[model samples]
Target: MTNEAFQQLLQGGVVLLDGATGTNLQQAGMPIGVCPEQWILENRDVMIDLQRRFVEAGSQILYAPTFTGNRLKLAEYGLDDQLGAINQGLVAISKEAAQGKALVAGDMTMTGQQLYPMGELTFDGLVDVYREQAQALYDAGVDLFIVETMMSLQETRACVLAIKEVCDLPIMATLTFEKDGRTLYGTPPEAAVVVLQNLGVDAVGLNCSTGPADMVETVRKMYEYATIPLIAKPNAGLPELDGDKTVYKTTPEEFAQDGRLLIEAGAHIVGGCCGTTPDHIRALHEAVCRLTPKAPHASHHRVLASERQVVEIKLDGSFQVIGERINPTGKKKLQAELRAGKLDMVRAMAREQERNGASILDVNMGTNGIDEKEMMLKAIYEVTGVSGLPLSIDTSSPDIMEAALRIYPGRALVNSISCETEKRKKLLPVVKKYGAMFIALPVSDNGIPKTLEEKHAVLDELLADAYDHGFSPEDVVVDALVATVGAAPTSALDCMATFSHCKQDLGLATVCGLSNISFGLPDRIYVNATFLGMAIASGLTMAIANPSQDLLMNTAAAANMLMNKEGSDLAYIHRMQYFDKKEAERKRQEEAELLASHGTAGAVETAGESQDAEQGPVNPVYQAVLEGEKAAVVALAQQELAHCMAG
Candidate 1:
């Protein structure tokens, strides 16, 4: 069986893997001073017997005994002359142990060196060592490459890239980190995950340096940023030598329990590394078999503190909500302010919408006869300073659009462009160059299309043109044009139908100025709210609306809940509790004012009252006596108690 086949076996369920070949070899009569790879070749029977025991112990994936067989390390043993002969012999020994029942992964480990700028190792030289080793393993027909115990991202990335150049086999890489969850060079777990994921490593994880308990936390962090499958191969525990023999203190049961916890944390594949034995892998297999992994839910895109937020534009769906609060659209005050180049107002508006749940903010600088470019620049800078929420730069001027994107951090959604060649040629390049997102309107030089077919035709051309300009299908959002329902009877459905078509055919996301659907209509809020529900069901990713409006904000929250898009309901539930409290308080105040106007003017009283009234007043004759002694106070007390009793 090939190593790839073993990975396939791992995918089907838990697959046992042998561990600690070097340590095992040291214990099995191999001299400690000699290279383990050379010693294993010299005593093939010892290596074969080790693998046989592991296979009998339930290991399905047996790694060849060639941990330091790379040319660079072999030279230290003065055996650089026999690199191929040694590797071939090691593979032969592993294959014989496999007996056609197990898979053999050719082992590669860190060179016990560092790479610059962290250390003296050169990138090219590191790549050369990995490339040389990878070829030797590939030619020997080993199952896969396990580049384990990697400590530096630079070196790891180089080795992985070099291995890919020489072989098409799947690579499983693991980096060793310190107890603080950082590589020796300070690479955080999440950063390492993102870097490795983006590099398209098949399975990435932690190994060698950490034990099972520490590996669980690190694996959780890795799973957060990783899109690919994950692997966790932690050490049994840090070893301490006892009379020339190193010993890992963790029992097989303890290590197995930790392995199961790592699997729960989203490691699809699990095994043991340094100081681990065949018994540990066997127990791990049993542990994994008894456990059920938690399936990860779909993730919402978020802008993290360290990375600028990104808003993906989906233009071809039903209706997109392009948040309008950022633009000086309806407010003459805001328009005048923008024209005057006062950007603090813009920043405040952006922050408000972002806090109120704006997915994408729409920015427009299209004021009467002003330099749109300059206004756009100031607006972009000012808003981005306060809120890193992705923007939809709303402008028709190419120059203004280009300039806004230059300063805006992260990927942004361009307001729009038609299918016209001139607009596409000018705008698409700018989007491509800045890695900006965009929206495409279904209109050509002739203007906005009147029918669904015309709309589809324009959308197709726009998408095709966008792709020609290096835009991926994911980067382009299609706006099917939300025409005013009040203006034309066919407008609303046409927009929705176009949205549906784009989502299904073009596979692009859609956006619309939802308010435009009810423009000039009486009771616009009702129409806007109803239209929004329809649009969301139609696959709209975002919108440009006043999130401050209760209806819009409530609708988005409710929609997220119903659609199961929001991860948790704690925030919404808490907000509802606050609302319930406010409503109760308002009712209480109104009831108090009613009672005070009709009855005696006194402090509000609860249903249970008169507990502190004078005990003597409990007697009717005493009450009558107090009525005359403290007439006003007694009268007020009587009124309150009477009201409470009546109620």
Candidate 2:
């Protein structure tokens, strides 16, 4: 189905989705430990009857019984060789059952293999798997695609990318959150909404982990950030053991009552999950059919997200710092490490900057004697493993940027898209495709604009081009083109004017390389911090800077408080508390190092020992992997294996 058509359907009212596929099929004599898709094809009449009941009972959309039809899952029953036949057969059955009454969505789910750094599956490998299944479903003429019961947000992204690569089918994704309202991988509901919607999912929400009542709060959380439709497909209730069988005790009436609460809590689409039947969907439809669906929250809220956190960028919100320490431009140590294909320094920098309150981490892997794209991907994997902060993919190469965005697994901020011919031609489409927010540098083929008028003109042209590529102002963060004050006396003033114009006149967020204003000057930190305060006053949204500098970070906090930005007072106070705690820890580490420096046998222990002592309890193997200590990992693994074998 076209996205426009699907949206028009939602505009009519609440979109009712069909209830439980696996659970209902099991009740229809589908045996356990057998391939569900294969069984459905063998007993097509039973499957058709069940779905037809849902359609008659008021399900506007029916999920085809292709949930586990992906190649990997079918391989468990040795049906992988017939993957195409199984998926096509299942879609055909659902289409037959629909009989023009409802639309058939090609259902998808997790591959049962975890993504890299957790299990063996690589991101590209998983995408290829979903691509094969999605192609089969598309060939079978499924109207749309729905990826449900996803535990990993990364895996969901793979599925959406796969489907989009195959066709422009309307895709909806839902995660199964734990009772505490986070996925098994620690992604919260709001993060899921922000990340998936930004990745171009037609609808994003929760399904299967809990009953309708317990899902209300998470639905509300997702609603606050959602710019697309929200879906709630909760179970009948918490499953219970009844003798030898699993049962859901909530009656259809109770399920229907909670379904109304879900609609009220901002779910535009409502459905049933485990233990829900046609009767339950009928009750739910009766309960919520008349109520007006809640409209999705309006877009243009500038936000970036990692897998676990969402960072909102506002024109007047707290000043955000995109940590700049991960770049290997002038850092000789980092450059050497990158050349050796080691990401230990990169991982350390990411963790340190996050601890220092960086809102985003800027990752730039450009260096001599190293493959930039290869190192960039490696850096992304390492940083995401250690930090929950969203990353700024800083690269001058469009090819590298596309490679990074394809597998980065979160909503990244493209370090820039300028009006330069090569950049506009190559980068804009990929940025839009990945749903990334980008730093719009107002430099064209003629180079830096000499005047504020010229700069604004460049920005206007770039924005017009972005619009042509289907981007909104919310997706564009204007770079105010920071020129050195040492070169132009009025450079800082011009930049502040650009910031004010972008914020007040154009209604867009702004960012800058914070230290560029003070280049070729003495005590650059003071100049940098002072300029940052002024920029924040003039409506700067975020800046790429070294967040480890207390002066710059404190000035940002103080500026936010002075501007009376919401929650800045508490934020400043909390920052002070964190500083105090950090200072105490630093002093304790110093004393421990001093004591260890003078060993009892006059052989000074290394600083690593002192730090390890202060940190308490170490998993050496895990630490070795985290630090990218390849030799240490090999030695440690061999030692552990030898011990296991000897025992």
Candidate 3:
């Protein structure tokens, strides 16, 4: 037990976690659409009184009413700068209320920025925000951190990783899943356990979900593989509208009846989530006391995840693309625009890559005579906030890496680390601290490895360094030293050998700069696509390239289908649909131009046709209303409502 008192309680039987903070606060006159933390600070007595009731009701773990007190969420109230003060204030009040009775946890949650592939938040950014709040809570003194009601597995990962970095407090991570046992974002029970348990959280469970009964199977799934204690804090059987207020459907007795299912399923902690009262907690406390934890089972250990989904990288699984267009590496126009303080192009490129099926976007803002750190952070924010895809934080500077890594909302893939001692000393700790995945470019004091023997030796050194810094092979993606054919004709052949060796022999995932194969060549996209197909055939799991190229994307999609990629054909089909429309539009433009060859008369007629297409048909409802047909309009509106209801 990271917190001694809480651990002792766990040893006896089921440790009791508290009921809903929001619902209880609302019952005490805290309104919706206002910051709960701020309201609690203003009405301290209400919160303290509510907590006292929970303690009396037998809750041993009380989460502080600091759910959305992080800087990003607080920024909505112009309170971002007061994050520390707000968190400190929360811990102080909760501690005072606990008063040597129930232990208080520093409650943290998401920034409402949905993590990448779902919404704009980055892993590093989420980690930074949570660390800021955790530090404050620890400073003001709290027993542990409870990141609850988390809707995304990746955001939950960020929160736990962040807390582990800032404090040694026992961390409990609970996610909000739907009745189907997966989160709304579709992270099933065991997938979440794989990620959370590997991160070494004290307890993993479901909270703020449908009800205790609905969570039993989910708890069972987790129990099957969870070696640590499991938690089950569910809603009081969903909410219903009680006139203007929300009400819990499950009564105290009924809710407690559901707890037996979770307990039977091997839950070590049982409590309530939304709409649960102290009465509910009291019943649960009594019921949970009679249940005992069951033996745990073993499971697959490696998990690399995004905010909304998990990426289970088996020995031979699906290939992934990390789009390279977000970087301003060799593009003069983008470089000029970025230096001029613009991100429109970066956003456009991000969307384009996402459209072309890039699993992640590689972002590099390094340019001469510019604040690389500032630009990288902005680019990360723009790409992530808008495109909402995972990113590779591409930078050589340690400061730039740390800055971008801190604020990125999803788990980021670092572009590199080498055998340079200073680089290792500075970069490896940051990666380990944040728990971000990384790409290993094995450069030793002897320079870039030229042979399999040299590359293997360099890889061995990097692996040793990584382990020394608390990283695992599952956390690494080895960069295929794909050398340019112009520099060395056999470079391409040697690259293939390295990629095959890494994926097949060494059991490591491999990434390559795809366009490097066609450098200094004409029709590069076609060449790159061909090389990409060969690479994919050779077991290259990842590639950093321009996903916007039709040929390259087509080739990649084809390879996935050829390799029997499950469901990848859907993306390929969508691409075909897009290309069909594109071809149609191209033909239309050509036809229109040919028609306009008769000069101004044809062009004018074409313009008129375009205008007619835009106008479409007139609305009968608007016409009737304009003609003073009130009764007809009323009939139309009522009919529309009826149709909508029927539909």
Candidate 4:
């Protein structure tokens, strides 16, 4: 295919590419530490056979034996002077091998050493190498240039820019990262996407460093940052040293399954690298072809943010249960309002929390001196009107609960009904009749269970009542009631145990009033943030906390990615861009203030001094005010206003 045609291919359905070159050549007795490109010319029969196998395996594009044909790499084996001859021979041999079938790409690998800031190799030097290599490969009429196994963004950008400068071929670049999901230089997937996408690569993705499962995650992350097509060329799982030879344990069928996942994760191209065989590629080809192509418009419309999962309008997926920030039980303002029988504090809390990332604001009108039922209704109207993010109505009063549930829009979470006899009989029935999801606290009439087993029993009773109340397992969030850590040092552990039991045993998602765990403690923010992370790690699906606190909000944002809810660094980048704009505005105001105070006087001095002595003494201060320094202008305007008023 021509370079333009290949670009078109990327925009359509899945295109299969060739598998491992080194492994195939090694099995054919190509010598190690020798030039694989040179061996392709010498052992033309094996090279031809390899190309034919890839074609048979359904590779629409086959790479020429040019992985190490660059000047710097080829010079290692004293073949630097043979760049044109070696590349020309690869084209000549691979064309004959293909017998006019598969499209050939000029393959380029890393320089195997170091680059600037870490090594001696300069950006210009690296580009010179790739430029020369690309020029030779393009002149020989290769279909595209594949820059493979790159780890450094700097080096990769240099290579891609250099190649594009010399040749107009389509470029597919892949960076190799360690199993930790980061490059050797610690470049994360999100950073890689921004760097490569901005650098103008035709396609950007991961290859050669990880297995299928891990690669699936990598590809998913790449999709978040990738505007271009993605390529997945994972090894058949990680390779192992079987005696003297490295062996890939995963079978072709198993490998194909991983390839299928990469396809689902939005990979437009699929192939095997290093340890894959034609058998692997053939299975992948069949596996990929059997699957119906995803709709172009459908995939494009799908929204992904930094690892935060959307709480859709459905009752099945995890809902963004915003912890109600409207309770006045802890706050003095709300406490005084509660005594005065006012519910306006609840309204303010709800609006503030919703704006700061609360999808479902938790509303609690349970303070002394208040008619709980009367207060709940007033708060609901005030909150739902300001923000359309759903509400979590919290109260034990059946009358109060019924009133709030009547007005709540979308799917509302009732927080909560305990395992207490009266709660099960009264509140549970209300939740069932209203078609609202309920929070089942692992607490009995005597209060929250102290031990995990007791909490488990409470949850069991709550679940039984919930099902009897006509709620499914998914419709309830078992609030593993976070007890204050300072009240009893073991409260944190007990809370964690409750979370685990609800998730692991009952198979129910859990939520917690995260702030309670850190209450009455120093650095409560730290405790709250730490507990939220640990609670999430223990399988807490939802949380109730102030999302406005950077510590708290950041923990949740981090949890989204860690839990694989949000796609990847895509969300993180978004947060930064938003925060950066905010920061820039603040800086501009500060600069303007500083300039108005000090800078305006300096400008006035320079302007006044420019005039001749023939002119009467000029008022620099008046000139400063006239120059539109708002701070100075305001000072003068205020003085004039005072004189006019005095007169």
Which number leads on lDDT?
2
Better of 1 and 2 by TM-score: 2
Candidate 1 Cα misplacement greater than 4 A, ranges: 1-7, 118-122, 241-245, 294-647
Q: Highest TM-score, which number?
A: 2
Clashes of 3: 8
TM-score of each: 0.52, 0.94, 0.74, 0.48
lDDT score at residue 56, model 3, on the 0-100 scale = 90
Clashing pairs in 4: 306-571, 307-566, 308-566, 323-544, 324-362
Best-to-worst order by TM-score is 2, 3, 1, 4
For residues 56-120, write the lDDT of model 3, one tens digit per residue.
99988788888898889999998889988998898888877778788889898878887653466
Q: Write the per-residue lDDT of candidate 4 for residues 1-647, one digit (tens) a residue.
A: 45579867765578888888898889989878877888778899998888798899898888888887888888888999999999888987777766667778888878876864346785567778888888888888887878888876556766777786786678888988887887776666655664455345677788897776778888777786566788888887888999999988889999988788888877787788988999999999999976643322212211111111223322122324465568776688887876786655565566557556676777787777777776776666555544545567887678888766544433467788878888678887666544466778777887867677787887887788778755666567777777787888887787777767766776677777778887777888998888877877676767777766766776766766676664436665565575566566567566556766876866555444543343567554575443323335567767768888999
RMSD each, Å: 16.4, 3.0, 8.7, 22.3
Weakest lDDT window of 10 consecutive positions for candidate 3: 298-307
lDDT per residue as tens, model 1, 266-331: 887677888877888778888886565543323312211111333333232122245687666577
Q: Write the per-residue lDDT of candidate 2 for residues 71-148, one digit (tens) a residue.
A: 999999888999898899899999999999999999999989988877889999999999999999999999999999
Of the candidates numbered 1 and 3, which has the greater lDDT value?
A: 3
Q: Candidate 4 has what TM-score?
A: 0.48
Global Cα lDDT for candidate 2: 0.91
Arrange candidates by lDDT, descending. 2, 3, 4, 1
